[model samples]
Target: MRADRLVSLVLLLRQHGRLSATALARELEVSTRTVLRDIEALSAAGVPVYAERGRHGGFELLPGFRTELTGLNPDEALALLVAGSRRGAQAFGLGSALASAMLKVVDALPESYRDTAAGAAERLLIDPETDLLSRRLVDEEVPDAIAAEVLRAVFAGHKLRIHYAAVDQTPMWRTVDPIGLVTIRDRGYLLATKSGADRTYRLSRILAAKELPEPAQRPDRVDLDRAWQERSTRFRTGGDQVTVLVRVNPGRREDLLGTALAVRAEEPDADGWLRMEVSFQDSRHAKWALWQLSMDAEALAPQWLRDFLRNRATAIATRYGVSS
Candidate 1:
């Protein structure tokens, strides 16, 4: 880590030409005393570093001394800089390291392109705080200590003991073989197995965690994308799911289909309506999703669902028709 710090320090000086001790300390996220010691180390190691005295003076590399690290074109440099702004790495407990790496990336660019690349990146936005719907994106916080433990087990191929709070269930301790960690939509999940059965746990719901000494019973190498796909498919198809036959206005066909899990069959009706057999996670999900389409979609089969909707509509009509 010290070696990494030393290399970053050299890159910093190379980029800026000169920086005060306080400035170097701030950029390196280390104490000024450490920066001074590293400067001494650099000079003693034959680097052409020299110091200047006075309030306006600071440390600088000897004139004409440049490290050969300018390989990126302006667009490539800007792309790297923009990607470095992502907060996803923070969820994996690499926030500080990501920041340091970004600094090095910017510093490595050619002097003529550095400022321009950085300025261009600043003008672009990724993952804005709020969308047009005025919904704010929130990042869940995982304590540094807990994240470190999770990452340690994941990388070291060890089993993990976690206190997980499943939805609608009491918190319980689980020992899982951590297959991998995945972050989606700013939330983190541990894709693991318990007794060789696939299980996924949200990092936010991990009330507590501990790493076990036993080696994890997972593959030597994992394809996370494939693993996620398989798990997602199983979850979608293997629940207490329901299938409904529904008639929807042809114009709202896409809207109805979008809410349903899948369309098993479709046919055009006499009045230009579309009859579809759709699947939903469950009856409640079916009712809720169909309710969103109001009169445009009607559940035609599963007598119970049709009766439920009829009763609901009747109650509403009854209420409106009552005399004052």
Candidate 2:
């Protein structure tokens, strides 16, 4: 099992630019030694997976060695393209050299497969009005098996072993319970209650992870749905560095509190508004938050929040002749 996994790990990293041995172990559910042995196997097999030794080190394939993708049906071809389109979708098993390899596979296919591939091409475009990315990248795979395991580890009382990364982070291993997966199509993500506060992590950002059963699972009131929603609204387009502590209107407090955008920062007000603080990095994002509030919410703050809103009101008056 260990030796077989090493080969797969090598292929995984070779195909996907880099991964730490620890990350490989998490994905393979083995010890670090096992992953190392696997790497040794690859080196012996003429697959050049080199180790990057340092704070930034991880395994990467030797350049100029490209594997040819062969034996794909039309469904496989279509699946490859569509999968490549999604963030982190490439991990599903389409090798790294996707396009050129795909073309090669298509050329070798029976005429029927070619006809189907053409039909798929004509049938639909993934996103007609999608914003064109300056640089498009193929996402690696996140098998449903792995996804399901994460949920089990976090919500189902298990610990996770992961190959994880962060800004300036060297990919390393982690043992975290699957908290809950935060679905961001562009990137695979999760929210784990690691280090006390629940941390949201992009899945691909995590090189690998797995769950454990011992130490027991911690209890929480993490409504995955609510958390996901909260995460979505926590950012402002152009916002000031203020945490807008607001009391929702008496009539709308419950409804507002239920919303994903409503960050539950405090208690309900005597007037029935739920009091909470909304943090912003700058005035632009702050104004954007205020704009979202429309009439249902008000900013109760460090004076600046109110002043900003007032100025916004004045600007509105000056622009459209509404009120001063």
Top TM-score hit: 1
CA lDDT of 290 in candidate 2?
Answer: 60
Candidate 1 per-residue C-alpha lDDT over 1-324 given as tens digits, one digit per residue, 9 for 90 to 100? 899999888878887878999999998889999999999999999998999989888899887676435778898888888988888877777788888888877776667888899999989888887898999888988877788899999999999999999877999999999999999877888999999999989898898899999999998999999999998888678788899999999888888877787888999988889988989988888988888889998888899898888898899999999987
Query: Where is the poorest 10-residue window by lDDT in model 2?
Result: 87-96
**Candidate no. 1 TM-score:** 0.73
Q: What is the C-alpha local distance difference test score of each model?
A: 0.88, 0.62
Q: Tell me the number of clashing residue pairs for each predicted model.
A: 0, 33
Model 2 C-alpha lDDT per residue in residues 1-324, reported as the tens digit of each score: 455455456556644578887887886678888778777877888887788899878889887555534577668877765644433333322233344344444444556666677568666666332456645544445655565556567666666887777756688876665555554544567766665655567765665556676643455656778877666655433223445677666666555444323353777777766677655656565667665667888877767768878897889878887543
- Quote the lDDT for 224 in model 1: 96
| Runs off by more than 4 Å, candidate 2 | 1-70, 84-105, 117-127, 130-241, 247-274, 322-324
